[model samples]
Target: MENDSVEGLKKYTANNLLDFLTKQIDKDLMAALVKELGGTVETKTNSESF
Candidate 1:
């Protein structure tokens, strides 16, 4: 039971960390694209205006 609990915690932590890293990477990519397009990133609640 304890081992299962530890495994579950590890999986949860890994998923959270992966999600964070993915978001960071996506942001970086978006920034690079915007720079390449010669536009700015304007973030909105439901959409992004460049």
Candidate 2:
């Protein structure tokens, strides 16, 4: 698996992951996941820059 190999540990986006495999990263690594997990949209109009 990619977790064991240093060469395969490079960062990747959701679109780049394997078709058959699903990977879930922590919020520290995936910020957008907070919307779904926290039950808030956090839309662009919310007046937050980040």
Candidate 3:
């Protein structure tokens, strides 16, 4: 039972990290697109607003 709980926790943490990284990558891709299109990239800590 303890081992199962530990494994579950690990999986949850990994999933959350993966989601965070995916969002970051998406934001970076958007920034690149904006730069490519000759637009300004204004970065925010909590949100991305151009």
Candidate 4:
């Protein structure tokens, strides 16, 4: 029973870490895409303010 609990904990920790990494990667990718389209993005937002 104790061993089963330990295994469950390990799996839970691993899954949490994987989820965190996936979100971090997504944010990094979005930032890179925004940087690549910097001027176009800025222009759209700026025009919308009018």
Candidate number of the best lDDT: 3
For model 3, the superposed segments whose C-alpha errors exceed 4 Å read: 1-25, 46-50
Worst 10 residues of 1 by lDDT: 13-22
What does the lDDT read for residue 46 in candidate 1? 46
Tens digits of per-residue lDDT for model 3, 1-50: 22546656544543333334446667566565445444455565855646
Task: Give per-model TM-scores.
Answer: 0.28, 0.19, 0.33, 0.26
lDDT of 4 by residue, 1-50 (tens): 22546656544543333334445456444443344432122222354411
Local accuracy by lDDT, each model: 0.47, 0.35, 0.49, 0.38
Which prediction has more favorable lDDT, 2 or 3? 3
Model 2 C-alpha lDDT per residue in residues 1-50, reported as the tens digit of each score: 23525543333333233322343333234444333233222223563524
Candidate 2 lDDT trough over 10 residues, lowest sum: 34-43
In order, what is each prediction's RMSD in angstroms? 13.0, 9.9, 13.3, 14.9
**Judged by TM-score relative to the true structure, which candidate is superior, 1 or 3?**
3
Residue-wise lDDT of candidate 1 within 1-50, one digit each (tens)?
Answer: 22546656544543333334446557655554444434455444546755
**Which ten contiguous residues of candidate 3 have the minimum total lDDT?**
13-22
Regions of model 2 farther than 4 Å from truth: 1-29, 39-50
2 or 4, greater by TM-score: 4
